[model samples]
Target chain A: MKHNSYFDGKVQSLELHTENGVATVGVITPGQYTFGTSTQEKMVITAGSLRVKLPDQDWQTVMSGEFFVVDKNVSFVVEAEQDVAYLCYYF
Target chain B: MKHNSYFDGKVQSLELHTENGVATVGVITPGQYTFGTSTQEKMVITAGSLRVKLPDQDWQTVMSGEFFVVDKNVSFVVEAEQDVAYLCYYF
Candidate 1:
């Protein structure tokens, strides 16, 4: 297990092995952020929500229990009004 | 946010704020452990499952998307056969 911190500890993640494959459970503090992905990521909102802007798309709210996918080798944007918890699976 | 490690890091948690109150997201390795709570806890399984024995009750399985509540000032037992991720809300 590994714990990774990003954006000066405002965002942190714990790596774990899941039935679906390698995944991370992370928390993001209230702020706006842009993330780049190496693998295609399936971002599942476990608690709270994320306002996301995918490539060539409009901003959308992804609520708890909902998910959004990000393609590999692209940078995407996310905004959080409050602390958000998510589980991301890389494929 | 604080990251708390327990059981020699076999169980670790990251603290966060949520609409429900103060909460933590954590991961547990494959093992059995007992925990004592100071506050009433709402334990939600985010990934995998927990074999839990609440106080005097028999062991039962708590699957993902399912939750179990533990009373304050009590000790409970939980066993994981694989890596399990969960969110615990304290009230």
Candidate 2:
């Protein structure tokens, strides 16, 4: 029952329970933001697209129905060209 | 730039801009709630599942990647077993 809203309310998330693990479904407005994670996160793009720059990796555009993973304790940058909807599973 | 959270923060949504129309990406906790709409809405389930009862329609379960529409000025009931993530487009 975690409802976290950040970045001036431009980004918001709802905690979810899954069979495998804990996940979050969130939405991001058109902007760039940095994120830090405590656990390995698998982020799936459910709508729109995200321009992501992972650690030591080039910027990549993740589209809808696509997914990307961020290592635990890692920080990343993401830019949304449009309103981006994502589901992130923590492991 | 609308971030509206309802039902004691159990439900949250972020306004989105799409090519076709305005949409909302939101998440519902494990509860039953009634929603009133001012415009026609096309709700798409992106993750988890939702039990929805539209006007004059039976209680229907909408799974991930599925969708349902509600007429303008109508009200509907939706229940989530787990956490339900949805994208709603308004027309």
Q: Of the candidates shown, which would achieve the greatest TM-score relative to the real structure?
A: 1
Badly placed stretches (over 4 Å) of model 1 are none
lDDT minimum window of 10 residues, candidate 2 chain A = A12-21
Please give the TM-score that candidate 1 achieves against the real structure: 0.98
Question: A81 in model 2: Cα distance from truth in Å?
Answer: 2.3
Please give, for residues A1-91, the per-residue lDDT of candidate 1 as tens digits.
Answer: 7999999999999988999999888899999999999999999998898899999999999999999999999999999999999988999
Predicted structure 1: clash tally? 0
Winner by lDDT: 1
Clashing pairs in 1: none
Q: lDDT by residue for model 1 over B1-91, one digit each (tens)?
A: 7999999999988888998999999999899999999999999999999999999899999999999999999999999999999999999
Docking class of 1: medium
lDDT of 2 by residue, B10-90 (tens): 888777787758888787888999999999999999888899999999999999989999999999999998878788999
